[model samples]
Target: MRRNTGVFIAFAIVFCWFALLTFLLQFPTVFTEPWPYILLLLQTHLYTGLFITAHDAMHGVAAPGNIKLNTVIGFVCALLFAFNWYPRLLPKHHQHHHFVATEKDPDYHGGNFWAWYLSFLKQYITWPQMLAMALTFNILTYFFPLENVVLYWMLPAVLATFQLFYFGTYQPHKGEHNAENKHRSTTLKRNHVWAFISCYFFGYHYEHHDKPFLPWWKLYQEKDRSFK
Candidate 1:
């Protein structure tokens, strides 16, 4: 089987980044200073990255030709982000691709943003997972500063759900873009910085539908391609 070097690099980078953020959050001075808030924001993006990495695995591109490795990577990433059920996510995500923005799509929502977000949460959030997360939070806070645990570990995962919804799901598939694109998705106009910041260029939603195999880091290259 051919090696997916890029996927390996992307996974390594995200894992190392998560580790770095954990280290900074654990440090006494960093936890006490104003930097923890900024780190929390950065960690939110990293959490988004982990989700996207798992997403890439779902498409079989993250660790191409190595199903076991891909599954392990996706499961670990999702688990770290407080989502424990990768098996449940995998099939539902495939259904979303097949019936995108329609009633059949697990993520589909034709109404208000909050309502849609609530629906999305309802489908995935489980009682056991919440209890596990709460228990884990209690244990962590016993060892680390409560502020550090809340800001660095808890808040980012919560904010990342919003980030994923707003940038990846709601913004690209809402209103005008939905009407114009057959897939009910549209690409964000070229803006490299924001492109990278917002869901790793998943703002380029149409391009993603066209080439689902492309990894998140390479999605921006589609901006230059003539879709005609």
Candidate 2:
């Protein structure tokens, strides 16, 4: 099969799985019992994983070509997570790569652990006015008992949006990942499994920072021999 064809097949499977889970969650019988709630939580995380995959697709990491397709897929995925406005935020993300972690970057920050922690709040929450709008939708989920929409659908949608914003915008180009900070970069390896699973192999971020065009599957191929 063609590369794009394979990617679409993979995406379809994940999408179907998410749909099935959502369907099952809609019936109260599924969540009326403790075991069902546990299952629902697990499915919620899976939905988050699917959204993450959708995110990689938007970034052209999953499949290239067709800008319209990318945009539509991203919007649908974001909408599923209750944050469909993500495409509007892409310019800021794109700028982060061009500027890296330098002063010119909107996301730039010093590597001092405490400084980075404090700066993250400011960087991520830049538009306080928008927070009210964003929170309103999320808060509604708490009051509403739409089992599938709230637990399986909306929760993952929210997590995916936050993960994409953090990993895509902040983690990859952070000053801590700079070439001069080899020691800090070493920590990436320790968490490779989670990165591979949660971010669709985006956790190999150092390699990605070096070669942005490479696909996620090929990221491990570029891993430094020294690390092994």
Candidate 3:
């Protein structure tokens, strides 16, 4: 049931992103009110959801038994989220898991926030991705208001990178680990609501390094699991 639900949520996340965009991209009076700022934050969150779903796909949790369907969902999610290429993200993510905070971890760059974020971007961003985004942006302008596209579409995606980086990667992996911290990872103090709002419970990250096959939605359960 957990695996089946994850597969369904994977598609739901992708659909919600597009459904929200379709409404917000032409939303009236976007910049004229404080409510639109809330919309921006919500959109940014959905954008992060896109990446989180793709990350689950990489772990084979998003569509456990169907390889082709799983990869397709991930490919679509990543492509829509600023044209990120799923194939490229696969190996680097596993490398991060294998190496944790070591030099071989593509997501790590010591404890400096700026340095680590730049490294994270460099590890994932490519010229072709940038070019594809640019082309898509230009094409969208012909159909949607430039203000709406910039605010609802582009800005949230940019903010979501910071959101994902800060919560999912930087906080969890930065700084020194205690002697018994086998994964060299840190789990956030228990706050299930904030954990989900922050990064789909990715802040329960030590549990993640301990059980990589679990989907992002299940991290909270792992975070609260009992031991003998």
Candidates by lDDT, descending order:
3, 1, 2
Instruction: Give candidate 3 regions above 4 Å deviation.
Output: 226-228
Compose the digit string of candidate 1's lDDT tens values, residues 44-80: 8888888888888888778888788888888887777
Q: Candidate 1 at residue 215, lDDT?
A: 80
Candidate number with greatest TM-score: 3
- Give the least accurate 10-residue stretch of model 3, judged by summed lDDT: 219-228
TM-score, structure 1 vs. true: 0.91
User: What lDDT tens digits, residue by residue, belong to model 2 across residues 1-228?
Assistant: 465762674467467756666465555654447866665555655555555555555567555676666666665654444443555545655666677667766666766544665575455443542574468546655655655556655565456555654564446555445458532333257455676555655666667666666665566666654357
Tens digit of per-residue lDDT, candidate 3, span 1-228 = 855787789778878888989999878854667978998999999999999999988998888998998899888888888999899999989998999899988888974788778888888889998888888899999999998889899999999999999998899888889889999988898889999999999999899999999889888888888221
RMSD of each: 2.4, 5.2, 1.5
Clash pairs of candidate 3? none
TM-score on alpha carbons, each prediction: 0.91, 0.63, 0.95
Better candidate by TM-score, 1 or 2: 1
